[model samples]
Structures are given as C-alpha cells and as structure tokens.
Target: MSGVTLSNVVKKYGETQVIHGVELTVDPGEFCVFVGPSGCGKSTLLRMIAGLEETSAGEIRIGTRDVTRLDPAQRGVAMVFQTYALYPHMSVAENMGFGLKMNGHPKAEIREKVAKASSILHLDDYLHRKPKALSGGQRQRVAIGRAIVRGPEVFLFDEPLSNLDAELRVEMRVEIARLHREIGATMIYVTHDQVEAMTLADKIVVLRGGRVEQVGAPLDLYREPDNLFVAGFIGSPAMNLLPAHPTEGGIHVPALGPEVIACRPPGHVSELVAGFRPQSLRIGAGDTHSVEMTEALGGVSFIHCARDGQPKLVIETKGNHVERPGTDISVHVDPDEMFLFDKLTGHRLR
Candidate 1:
C-alpha cells in the first residue's frame, strides 16, 4: 500500500480557479474522506489525485513517485463513481475482470483476480448474474470488486453509495468499511454527507469554497471544531448558533434566556455567536421559547423550539417524550459545553 500526497495542489479552468492551493497527505493504508457541501472542491481534488483532472500547479505524489502529470491509469489509483457503470450485457464476474481482459492480461490471471475479489466482496453467489438481475447494493459491490481486482495502491470512491436506498446505504457502508480493513489499501473517499464522513473516515478533510476549512480524525473534529463553519457543518442537525453579546463577566444569550452565560470572550470581541449541540441542550423549567415541532424517532426525539427574533433551536431528548407544538419551554446549556465564535470573521474564539 502506498500513501498519497498533495503538495500545494492547484486546479484552474483557464482563468477560473476552482481548487486553490491544497496541501494534504493520506497515510499508507489510511481511509481518508473529503467532505463538504456541494460546489466545494472535494470531488475536484479527488479527481486531481486520480489524474482525472489536470493539476495546474503543485506536485502530487503516490508513495515517492511524482504523478502530477501522469494519466489516470499511471497513478496506481482505482476510482468507483456514484454510478455502478456496469455493462448490462456482462455477468458480475465478467464485469469485474473486464479491465484486465481489455489490458491484455491472460484469461487465467483475470479469473484468479476476479475470483479473489468476488470472495472478498461476498459476491461469490452472484458472479454469474447480470447487472439487471442483482440488487443495487450487489451492483455496487461488483463495481467495488472490479476496482479491487486491479490491486491499485489507492482506492478512490466518489459518493458510491448515493444511489442506494437508506437501508442499502447503511449496509454498503459496513461492507466498504470491512473492505478497507481487510485490504488495508489507501482509500480516499469523497462525499457531501457528514454522517458517512464521521463513520467511515480515519481522517477527514473538510473543504469549502475551494479551500480546506479543517482536517482531523472524526471525533477530534466533532469534539473541537476550528471555526463556525466546521462547528456547524460537522454535527448532525448542526450546532445551534445564536446571537450573543459579551457582558462584564459573561456572554448574554437572548435566545436561551435573559441570564448571562458565564463565559469569557476575547477582549476585543463585541459581537459573538454561541454554539450548542442539540444533544447538549435540555428542556428547562421556564417558558422562554415555544415548541415549534417534534420529531420523534422511536427511542429518541428532537424538539424544535422557536422564539420571535431568535434563531430556532433543536433540543435532543431521550425516550418517547414529545413536545406539543406551541408548548412553552426553556432551553438550557452548560457554559462549558458552549462554543464561541466571532460573528464578524466566523472564527472560533478559542
């Protein structure tokens, strides 16, 4: 397994620059994910590493070789796209070994590789089935098996689960995670879904507006985000950011209550934004806000609360407790659990 490295990588289409100077390194046998909103340069950067996109500037190295100007085939990387892209006419085994066949490999070698890949992906039973005869998940597994047969140094997945239903997506996620563990191959996955990023990545690169906002392990990014964007984007349902003002001894949050939260702010900061995860908040004893909605998902519930002129807040509660719409309630959050950001620059106060 070979590590992938990007040094000040840049991409541009004539005068339009989409990917700015990006610096990243995926350790050998590491599962790295590039995650962000739509129009962010995650996919573009992945394509650059795969040699699918031209690198306008900077160096890209696979292991020690500079592959910046190399073709996709020469980069020792295999990409699985969002679509299965299977040939309707070919059997699963045929599809998996087609690349080797096209490249002049002997039939015996193709069969051996295909067999091994099929076993690894649990596609042994469906090897003779055509794409039309298989389920969406099985088709995707075939696509993955095709890449596995190549034995590339790196595996690149471009939202390969986007086409699957929710149940199939979860099932495929487990399969992909298992595949990574078994093969120990360097994998760079691109997805706009934070849930996938959180569950699949050993390291995640959060990108936005053609630049990287932050990069770290999943829990590290979740527990301590670098900025407002990351703090809001990393968590499910997102962090609740409310307008706040620094007072003499603490910060005053208008949405929560009139009581000032005892948290120190930077000396020069005037306007501040306070962040709290839904799980960190609770329904307290006063009528500070009205319940707007409740999403009860069996064992857990998310109560959406709102107040006039204040940003809506979602509070996560356990059990089957449901808050009625228009029900008056107060939200409480510990000051220690609160995240502070400068409203002007959107930078963390830490």
Candidate 2:
C-alpha cells in the first residue's frame, strides 16, 4: 500500500475536463516523475493524488486504501510545492515539526522527528532560522525536511525546485535524487523541466493536455518514443523532426535533398511523424549543410543548418566548425539514429 494507483482517474471543473481517464500505478519505493509543458495537467495530477483536489470520476488508491475522497491529511502523503510554502515566522525546527505538533504528537516526539529530519537534510545549523533568513536552496531543503519529518508513505513534489537559480536547481536536483535513495520512500515528482525528470525518475510519465503520452524509463523515452509528443518532449534541446514522404522502402525527405534514403521504420511504425535527435544529424565531408548559426556550450556545440532552400535544422557537435548561412551543402543522417512517425497520427512509425 506504500505505492499509489490511479484507476481511470478524471478531473473536471464544471464543464471543462482537465484530466482525461488516467490509469497509473507507482510501485512501492519507486521514484516517478510527471513532466510536461505548462498547463499540461501535471500539477493537477499530483494534487489529485495528494487529496487536494476532488476527482470528478474514477478512483485513487494510496497504500492499499481507496483514498479518492479522503482528506489531504488522511492520505499518508506529504507534498513539497514550488513555492516552498514555509512559515515565515517559524524557525526551521518549528516549521518542520508544526504538522506533528498540530496533530497532537508529544512535544518530545515532535522535537525528535524534526531533529532527525534536519540532520538528514543538513538543516541542523539553521534549525533556529526563519524562512526569510535562509538562501533559496536552504529554504527549499527546509521545505523538504518538513516533508521528511512527516514520515509519510509517499512524497509528492510539485516543481519544488523551479524557483531556484539554474546552478542551485541542479544542486537541489542532485540532493533530491540522493534523498530519494536515502529514504527509499516512494516519490511522485512533477516538473516542466525535462532534466529533472531524466535525472530523478525511476519511471517518467510524459503528460500532454491532460492525457498520458507515455511512461517509461528515462532513456527508453529518449531512445524510443511511442508518439511524436513524447519524442519531442523527453530530450534536451528537443528532438528534431523533419517531415518526409513515405517511399517504397524508406522515406524521401525533400527538405534534405532529392535522395530517397532507404530505411525501415522502427518496429510497429505506422502513421506518424519523422524524427531525429540533433545528435543524430551529422555534418562533415560527404555530409554537408549551410550553417545558419552556431551555438557553443562548454561541453558541446550545435549547428543550426539547413539545405539550400529548406527550414533550419539542428545538429550537435563538439569540434566541427559551421559554415555561413545561405550556402548549399550536402548532409546525411544515420538510419539507426533516425525516427519516423505516421504522417497523420503523429505516432512513431515504429
């Protein structure tokens, strides 16, 4: 029962259905992440599981109990929100132990739990400090420590690290990853950030417009997406999609050139979109393109290129230099690295 389950879950506000039938299960002690762009219903799903919002239909179960209609406190889950939601007036220790104190636990026990969580989160040095007195990352740790002190069966994080600066966000991401391992508590995290999902999730659920796109391991979604949405949404810099016409044995990408490259769709490929990761788009001798612009990251580089009269294409590189824009050049893509989707369904051709 330490795990969570949603059976055909649906949510609505008046006439508008925000969540479609969503059937989901989180294995005990599993770290599951729900990721999507803004307004994709990822947060709504998390809140529903936290018992904050009512389900218009379907059932929600937590730890073997049907908690669909239960109060938030009765769900045996603790949530860390994007806002941190800390008590400005209370010190770290008091803030963390407040729930236990309100629930009428013994003073000594509440203090003990707060101390243990603070120790775990390394909040001991700031136990007496208030929220405003802490740095962004420190306050976030306090918020997580508060959730930890609850000792709930499941932890729900709703973009808890979104407010942090980029550098701190990565730091907190690693901390949360380590925390999940240390506690071994089942976690359901929601984020618009793909990096977080990729790094933290034992399983990642890619949601779109209230429906579940696909759920799988981080690399599984990256390497093999079931639909165009999942394919484009799961990776960094996003996957590059180049429309093509289906040919006898392969696809003819007129945008790239006149050649009809011979290749087979991934297993089960049918009506869907064609796709390729930027890293799969290669340029060098034998393969060429007109470089529109070049961006260099410390560890990698990207060339924004296109054919003589084609739309811009993105290619990843670390050492290659790009030519200027408006120049005609040849280019090639790896058949194994390429992706194809049904023209009509937007589902992966394979």
Candidate 3:
C-alpha cells in the first residue's frame, strides 16, 4: 500500500485552469472519495495522480517516489474506468493476467496472482468466459481483478458502478468495500452520487468549480457542511432556504405575516441566508407550511410544502399523510440544526 500526495497542484488547458492550487493527501490503506457534481475535476484530479494528465505546476508523490512527471505504468497506480475496458476477444483469466504477462512476470506467478484475485472477487467460475458472456457485475469484477493482479499500490475508480442497475450498484459498492478491507490499498474513488460517497468513504472530499470545498468523514460533512453549497449538495431532500430579514436578535418572515414570522437567531449569526434541512423542520401547531403537494416513496414520503409563494419545501416523513392544496400548516425547526450563510459570498458563518 502507498500514500498519495498532491502539493499545490494546478491543471490548466491553455489559459483555462481546470484544477486550482489543490493539495490533498491520501493515507496508505485509506478509502478517500472525491465526490462532486459533473465538471468538478474529480476524475481529472485522479488522472493527474495517475500521471495520465500532466499538472501545469505541482508535485505528485506515491509512497516515497516523486512521480509528478512519470508515465502511468511507472506510478504504481491502477485506474478502473466507468467503462469495463476489458479485452473483448480475451477470456476473463487472460484479461486479468494480461498486465502481468506484458510485464514479463513468470507464467506460474501470473497464474497464481490471477487465481488469487479471481477467488477474492468471486470470478473463479467465470474464468473462461469473455466480456460479452458475463453479467455487468461480473464484467466489472473482472475489470477489478485486472487491477488487482497488477498489485498496484493505489487503486483509482472513476464512477465504476455508473453502468450497473441500482441493485447491482449496491452489490458492487459492497464488493469494493470488501476488497479495500482485504487488500488494504490506498483507494481514491470519484463519483457524483452522494449516497455512494456517504456509504463507501472513510473520508469524503467534496469539490465544486474545480476546487476542493470540504473534506471530512461522511457523517461529519452531513452534520456540519462548510457552506451553503455543501449544505444543499450533501442531503437527500436538500436543505430548505428562505429569504428573511434580521429582526429583534432573531429572524423574521414577513411573508408569513406578523404572528408566525418567528425563529430565534442561529449560532453562526451573520447577515445571512438561513437554512435547515427539510427533515429537521416539523409541521406543528405554531410552525407553518403552505401545502402544495405530496410525493410518496414506499414507507417514506416527500411532503412538498411552501410558505407564501416561495419555492416548495421537500420534507421527508415517515408514512403517508393526507393534505389539501394551499392549506396553511405550522412547522417547528430546531435552532441548532439551522445553517447560516453569508448572503453575498455563500460562505458559512461558523
């Protein structure tokens, strides 16, 4: 296993910079996920570390070797792309052992390595099958087995499960976690899916506009997002935001009329946009919502309500509840769960 370090890294295409001065460290045997929306440079960053893309200026080190300008094969990193990228004509075993054979490893050693990897990924039964003959998950496992037989120090996955259906996605996710545990190699996974990041990462690096936004454990980022972007980006139903004016050391919603324009000031007080997750706000006698619609998803339901004529609120609730259109309903919000963002900069107050 090996650690990866990027110091003051910058990636540019002509005059346009796709990656800013980025600095990050992936610990040996740690599972670090690079998660962000599309065009956020996550895969690009991974490619830079793999030496597939040359950094405009910076240094990349794998273990103790400074490999900023090294070719991909010499970087001790293996990347599994979204596409299976398997050799169509070759059998699973040949594909898995292709790297070893090309590198001139002994025939017996290649067989032993491929066998061990196939056993680990449960591909032993499909060794003779070609890519077209295997299921999606099985094909992906063969792809992973190819990476495994190389015995690389770092494993990089670029949205590896995007092609699979939901059920297979979950299965592959668990398989990756198990593989990480069994092999104990440094892994950097990139995906736009928050659920994947939340479930699979030991540490999550959230990115935006080609810059690092926040890095922390999954639950920590969920609970204490660094800014409005993160607060809205990290949750399932997303945080509810409302325009309000500061009043009497608290916040006021003039649109809700005089009586119900109530909520104490949040801890991170600033000339801010007040925010709270829809899940954290509750409908109560004193709290309020202007019911617009409802969306039910099995045991859980998404109650879409609004205040005045503003955008609807997406609230997740346990069980179905009947509601009429445009009916006024009260909702309670816990002050501690509220997040405050500077109106102009969108930066968090604390």
Off by over 4 Å in 1: none
lDDT of 2 by residue, 104-138 (tens): 99999998999889887888899998888999999
Local accuracy of candidate 1 as per-residue lDDT tens digits, 1-350: 99999999999999999999999989999999999999999999999999888999999999999999999999899999999999999999999999999999999999999999999999999999999999999999999999999999999999999999999999999999999999999999999999999999999999998899999999999999989999999988899999998997899989888888886667899999999999999888989999999999989999999888888998999999899999999888888899999999999988
What is the lDDT for 180 in model 3?
A: 92
Kindly indicate the candidate among 1 and 2 with the higher lDDT.
1
lDDT for each candidate structure = 0.94, 0.86, 0.86
Q: Give all TM-scores, in the order shown.
A: 0.99, 0.94, 0.93
Task: Please tell me which predicted candidate would have the highest lDDT against the true structure.
Answer: 1
Per residue, candidate 3 scores C-alpha lDDT tens digits across 68-179 of: 9889998998999999999999999999999999989999999999999999999989999999999999999999999999999999999999999999999999999999
Clashes of each: 0, 13, 7
Question: Could you tell me the C-alpha RMSD of candidate 3 in Å?
Answer: 2.2
- Give candidate 2 regions above 4 Å deviation: 264-272, 286-288, 320-329
